[model samples]
Target: MELHSHRMTALVLLMAAVALAGCRPEAEVAGGALDATDGDPPATRTALDPAAASAPITLEDVMEFDPRYLIGISYPPGMERYPGLAAELRRYAEAARAELMAAVEDLGPSSEDRMRAPYDLALSFDLLMETPEIVAVQAGGSLYTGGAHGIPLVARFVWLPQRDEMLTAASLFQGREGWHEVSAFVRESLHTSLSQRLEADALAPADRFRLLASGGEMIDEGTAPEAGNFAQFEPVPGVDGRLRALRFVFPPYQVGPYSDGVQTVEVPSAVLLPHLSPEYRGLFAAG
Candidate 1:
């Protein structure tokens, strides 16, 4: 969804191409906006997608007519081979779908707000790096549920086929203290970036202070000393096949305003090695 009208128009057109093309959209509302009445019969004089007079609103109808409810999912080149991972990704999309259904129920069929910003979900996966050591993947997308903009969903998975489990951020560190160390480093980096951006904009002192104060709070909370706060991290591999760094990913509204978009801080191996769990240390080259 676009926060601005012009962008909204553009995104709607693009979404028709990108998102509508998948999930086998419904026939009734198949063409455009959900509550639109473009093809009403002369007798009806008025109608909506899933057109109340045409048929009852069912899940299938929603999927077929409203492209918004149609979850668009795409996998990387060889992700299908891993049934476990594939199932996990599908579950994520299904959850969003369930939520969309709930919202539809909340907003009755005749609600005008339903036309404001139709709900939607689109996910894409990138097979960042795959090897015997680890199968690193990054999954990201947007979920729109009638807002000015869609909420971002992002995740990083380091699948260990040998261990038959994921290498989560919490498990990678020795103890709670590791989070504190990484938190401090990431917080500093993000704050510095925010300062540079504010200065570059050359706003008045009052505006600068207002932005810095609000942005600082978000960065602090988003980068707090907790594994959950820094849940999404991408592993950067070195030539030697060892992890050279971890790029922590913070979705928009987590570390800054939505306009600022997603932000990241790449903590090199040297900065992370000290706090890494003994067993996990082998995943990285000595920094």
Candidate 2:
């Protein structure tokens, strides 16, 4: 399930806030935002060529409705094969791109921090140049037929920028280290974005909450004549004694005049484990 609109919008705003706040130090490294030159190889056009690989796929390319998800093209011999792999590839790629866009836009302008402007610019530039890959991680064992969880699958895409050269997922996940890696990127991005927009003035709190509440009210209206729902998050304790929580709220909010009438229903961790990205799942499993 997708995140409810209000939360999505709020999270986007919060993520922007955090990115601007400089909460995490490794954002530059994890997001590949600070390791490239001004003229690093531009995002190639090869992704447009069906027979060519190594090209970066844009979010728009994967959003098109089609049976073939990988830009309506097939992978070459060397490309790894997996069931429903093409579709999953597109989904993850689009998701990754969307997150990247959100992260970048939240960064705002560089005038706020003239000294760090170059760092922000470097991150933006590297993001454009980086290519993310998807990897299939086994879920270990299954309960029913002893086979894998077939219908819903999980996968991981380790985003290793050629410039930074991170060691590996194992190295990153050593005692909350992996999550710190991701969080760091998000933090830096948030800090950069926030520092720039600090003096812009805050939105009206009353109006903002009212807008979200109205959206929630609309969702309540749509619930059944007798049924009801509530928002929540389910936490799954990690093997390493840490808790990995997955919170699934309502569908993303549709922006409009009455968009404020929305409510989000949270899904449990067990329900979401099957739906997480492979990379996300691996980080928890390793913990």
Candidate 3:
């Protein structure tokens, strides 16, 4: 216990040394390790002003006293209304916490020279688009544990109020051929984007193909026509209260090297309308 306490002191110093703006812990909000079985918003979250309270719903928790790690998890303001959605988000956050704890346990005695924080987790779920038909959220965040960089995590959720069902990429489409078509469209967009970056127009045909192939392989593999490959998406709503397009999100290392960071491709509704399940076709609009 004596050694453990000393190590915790080190964690504080390490966090202070590397903490970024707005990364400070919330003294009021306790750790979210336990479940809120009653399905109510975490009571510890601060109350918003009356004007803001009536708007979006938010649930956030940050902890810094763990001695071994630090964590932050927040949900969009409107999420509080959907107990089911809130529960799913909680489970996701808990899973991340478990992973961080396990990593901490496996860690050997801390050396005095290690400066980076041992383990840190930050997850923020943002409301992507909400229409009367469906509400979408983009879940993006990172988890770090003694590495040159933190691992990126992301997912998307679509909630149907009328059916009380959560829709995923797998559940949103029909036949396998549809996935193949969608895959092709995404690949074309990504390929063109890569070509522009490599300045293919300036290179000789041979050099263009060679240079494009170097980076395009990862893009192709990452965007295979499987539903899972395109699971993380954000809906782009048209001003007419309809869908304009859907942006597919790819975290680092999925479509390219970590240095490329996160990559996204917007597949216009025209391309996606044909592939969408019949029930969801009305949610989108072309042009």
Residue-level lDDT tens digits of model 3 in 1-287: 35334444543553443343145342122211111011111111122233432344345554554556677666655566765566566666777777777777776665731344456665665566665677776655566665444556566667766655666687777778777887898888888888787684588889888867877998889888897787777777788887888778776666766656677888889888777889888878965
Query: With candidate 2 superimposed using the best TM-score fit, by how many Å does residue 175's alpha carbon deviate from the native?
Result: 33
Q: How accurate is candidate 2 locally (lDDT)?
A: 0.27
lDDT of 3: 0.63
By TM-score, rank the candidates, best first: 1, 3, 2
What would the C-alpha RMSD of candidate 1 be, to one decimal place?
Answer: 12.2
By lDDT, the better pick of 2 and 3 is: 3
Q: What is the TM-score of each predicted model, taking all chains together?
A: 0.76, 0.21, 0.74
Q: Looking at candidate 3, what is the lDDT of residue 33?
A: 16
**14-35, model 1: which lDDT tens digit per residue?**
4454444435332111111111
- Candidate 2 clashes: the total is 31
Badly placed stretches (over 4 Å) of model 3 are 1-60, 110-117, 200-211
Best by TM-score: 1
lDDT of 1: 0.63
Cα-based lDDT at residue 18, candidate 1? 44
lDDT of each: 0.63, 0.27, 0.63
